[model samples]
Target: MDWDFLIDIFQQLLGGVPLTLQLSLLALVAGFILAVVIASAASSRYRLFRWIASAHIEIFRGTPLLVQVFLIYYGLGQIPGLRQSVLWPFLREPYWCAILALALNTSAYTAEIIRGAIQAVPASEIEAGRACGMSGLLLRRRVTWPIASIEQGQQGRCNSAVP
Candidate 1:
C-alpha cells in the first residue's frame, strides 16, 4: 500500500472540511424548517395541503440526490420564466444549488421521521394535555412536540448509519 500517497490525499481532502461543515449546517437548519412545514401540511385537515406535502415527499424520496442537484443546477436555467425572476442570481450559483438539493433531500426524510414520531405519541397523553386545557398549537408545543422530539432522537441514534 502507498501509505505516504494516501496520507497526502487525506491531508488535501481536509482542506475542504470548512466548506463541507458550512454546507451541512446550512442544510440541517433549512431542512429542519422545511420538514416541520411539510409534516404539518401532511397532518393538516385540508386535502390540498396533504396532497402537496405527500407529492413533495414522494417525488424527492423516489429520486436520486445527484439527479436533483443536476436538475436544479443545470435544468432550472432552461426554464423560461425562472431565469427572469429575482431568484435567478442565487439559483444560478452551484453552491446554492447544492445546498438546495441537500436541504430538499434531507427534508423529505426528516418529514417522514417527524410525521411518524408525531403519530406514535400516545392518545392518553394527548387526552391528559386536553384535560389540562391544552389544545391546538399549545397542546402540540407543550406535549406532543416534546414526545416526538424524544422519539426522533432515539430513532436518529438507531438509524445513524443511514445516509
Candidate 2:
C-alpha cells in the first residue's frame, strides 16, 4: 500500500552504493596483497616468520570485526604523536579508517585461503618442478602458483560473499 514510501527508502539505499563499492574494492585489493605476504610467511621454513604469520592470522581472524573497527577508528585518534605524523590525514578520515579495518580483517581470511590453496598442490608436483630445473620463484610461478591460483580464485569468490 505504501509504494511511494518504499520507493523513497530504496532510493536512499541506492545513494550509498558508490561508497559501498569503493570501500569494498579498496579493501579487497589491499587485503589480497597483504594476504600473499602473510601466506608466504606462514609457509616459510624459518620458525620466527612462521610464528609471526601464525600470530597475525590468529589475532586478526580471532577478533571480531566490530572490535577491530572500533580500535582503528577510535583508538587511532587516541595516539598522541599520531596527530603530527604523516598518516594523520588519512587516519582521521572515516572512510580510510573503515578501509584499513576491513583490509586487516579480510587479509587474515585471505591468507588462510591462499595457504590452503598453495598446500592443496601435490608434493610430487613440486618435486617434479624441481626435477625439471624449475627452482625458487620460477617453480612457484610456473607450477605451484598456477595450480594453486585456480583454487584460490574459486575459494576467494566463495569467501568474498558477505554472510
Candidate 3:
C-alpha cells in the first residue's frame, strides 16, 4: 500500500476511538451495576433469588455474544406486537441494541468475577467487622466490599487485555 494511503486509513480508524471508548465505558458501568445485583441475588439467603440469579447467569454466559446481539436486535422486531409498542421506537435503533448486547454480555462475566471475589473474602474479616459492631450492610461496606473491589479491578484488567 502507498504510505499516504496507509496513513489516511489509520487516521480514519483513529476517528472511531471516541465511539469505542464511549461504548466500552457505558457497558462497563451498566455491567457493573447488573453484576452487583446478580451477585447479590446469587448469594441471597432465599433459594428463589439464588435460583433466578443462577439461571440468568447461565443463560447469558452459555450463549455467544454475537448470537445475543442478533437476537436482541432482530428477534425482537419479529414479535407480532413488539413493533407497535411504545418501546419499539428505542428498540428499533442499532445503537441501543449494541449497547444492550454489550451490557448483557459484560454483566454475565462481571457477575462471575464479583461472586468469586465476594466468596474469596476471608471469613475472619467479616467476623472482625461484626465484632466491631458492624453488621449487615455496614460490615459488607467496610470489610467485604473493599476486598471484592480489588479483585474486580484485577480481573477486569486481565479480561480487557485478552482478545
Candidate 4:
C-alpha cells in the first residue's frame, strides 16, 4: 500500500464534497416537487391523467437505474431527431443525463411513498377540508400534503441514519 498516494487520492475525493452536496440537494428538491406532481396526477379524477402518471411510476420503478441511464444517455442520443433537437445540448452531457436518470428514479419512488402516505391519511381529514369549503386542490394541499411531508422527512432521516 502506497500511503502517500492513498492520502493524495483521499484529499482529492474530499475536494469533490461540495459538488456532491450540490447535486444531491438539487436532486432531492427537484425530485420532491416532481413526486408531488406525480402523486397529484395519479390521484386525479380523470382517468387519462391518472393512467399516464401511474404508467410513468410503474415503468421507472420496475426498471433498474443502470438501464435507464443507458437509455437516456446513449439510446436517446442515438436517435437522429433527438440529436438534432434543442435538447441535444443538455442530453449530450453525461452529468446531466445521470442526474436526470437519478431524479426520475427518485421521483418514482418518492411518488409511491407520498401516494401511500396520502392514502393513509384519515378520510375524515379530507371530509373536514370539504366541509370547510375546500375541495379539489385545496383539500390536498392543506390536509394531505403536510402529513405526507412529515412522513417523508421522518423516513428520510431514518434511512440516512441506517447503514
Candidate 5:
C-alpha cells in the first residue's frame, strides 16, 4: 500500500545482488562440470558406473536443498575427523557450505537434463556410425556425442533461464 516503503525495501535488496549473482554463476559453472561427469557415467558400458551415477543423482534430487546446506555445514563440523582435517578450514565457513549445496542441487537437475538429452539421440545414428566403420571414440566423438552436446546446451540454457 505504501510506495515509499516498497522503494526503500527494493533499494536495500539491491545491495545483496552481487552475492546472489556470484552464487548463481558459481553454481552454474560447477553444475555444468558435474553434468558432464554424470552424462559420461550414465552412458558408460559398465553397469557399476551407471548405477553409481544414478544413485548420486537421485539422492541429491530427492532431498530438500536447505537441509542439504545445513547438513554440509553443521553436520560436517560435528565430525571429529572432518573438523581436524585440512578441509575443515574451508567447510567451517558458511559461505562455502551454501555454495557447495547450491552446486550439488543444480548438478542434480542438470544431470537429469543431460541424461534425457543423451537418451533422445537416435539409435539409428549409432547404427549408421557402425556401418561407416565408426566405433568407440571415433563414433561417439563424431556422431553420438555431438548431437547430445547440442541438446544439452539448448536445454540447459532454457531451464536455467526459467528460474
Candidate 6:
C-alpha cells in the first residue's frame, strides 16, 4: 500500500467535514424546532391541532427518507409557479433540499419523543400545580415539563430539574 495514496484519500474526505457538519447541525436545529411545535399540537386540547400534528407525524414517519428526499429535491421543480417563486432559489439547491428532507424526517420521531415525555408526567403533579393556582403556560413552564423531563432520570423526580 502507498502511504501517499492513503493520505490523499484522507485529505479528500476531511475536506468535506465542514459541509457535513453544516448539513447535520442545520437539520438537527430545524428538526427540533419543528418537533416542538408538532409535540405541542399533539398534546393540545383542540381536535384540529391534534389531527394535523398526527397526520404530519404519521406521513413523515411512515414514508421512506429516500422518497421524501427525492420528492423535495426533484418534485418541487414540477410545481407550475414554484420555479418562479422566491423560494425557488433555495429549493433548487441540493444542500437545502437535503437539509429540508432530513429536518422533516427527524421531526416526526422527535415529536413522538416529546409527546411521550409530556404524557409521562403524572396527573397528580399536574393537579398539585393547579392547586397552587398555576395554569396554562405558567403551569407547563414551572411545573409540568420539569417533572416530565426528570421523570426518566435515576434521581427519581424533581420539580425543577435543569433550573
The list of candidate 5 runs beyond 4 A from truth reads: 1-4, 149-163
**Residues 24-138 of candidate 2: C-alpha lDDT, one tens digit per residue:** 9999999999999999999999999999999989999999999999999999999989988999999999999999999999999999999999999989999999999989999
lDDT by residue for model 1 (47-73), tens:
999999999999999999999999999
How good is model 2 by TM-score? Answer: 0.88
Off by over 4 Å in 4: 150-163
For 72-140, candidate 6 gives per-residue lDDT tens digits of: 999998997999899999999999999999999999999998898888898988999999999999999
> Which lDDT tens digits does candidate 5 get at residues 58-117?
988999998899899889899999988999998999888888888888888888887888
> What would the TM-scores of all predictions be?
0.88, 0.88, 0.83, 0.84, 0.84, 0.88
Q: Write down the TM-score for model 3.
A: 0.83
**Which of 5 and 6 is the better model by lDDT?**
6
> Count of backbone clashes for each model?
0, 0, 0, 0, 0, 0
lDDT of all predictions, in order shown?
0.95, 0.94, 0.89, 0.86, 0.87, 0.93
**In model 5, which residue pairs have backbone atoms overlapping below 3 Å?**
none
Report the candidate with higher lDDT, 2 versus 3: 2
86-140: candidate 4 lDDT, tens digit per residue = 9999999987887788888899998888888887777888788899999777877
Number of backbone clashes in candidate 2:
0
Q: Per-residue error at 42 for model 3, in Å?
A: 1.0
Evaluate residue 125 in candidate 2 and report its C-alpha lDDT on the 0 to 100 scale. 92
The segments of candidate 2 whose C-alpha lies over 4 angstroms from its true place after superposition are 151-163
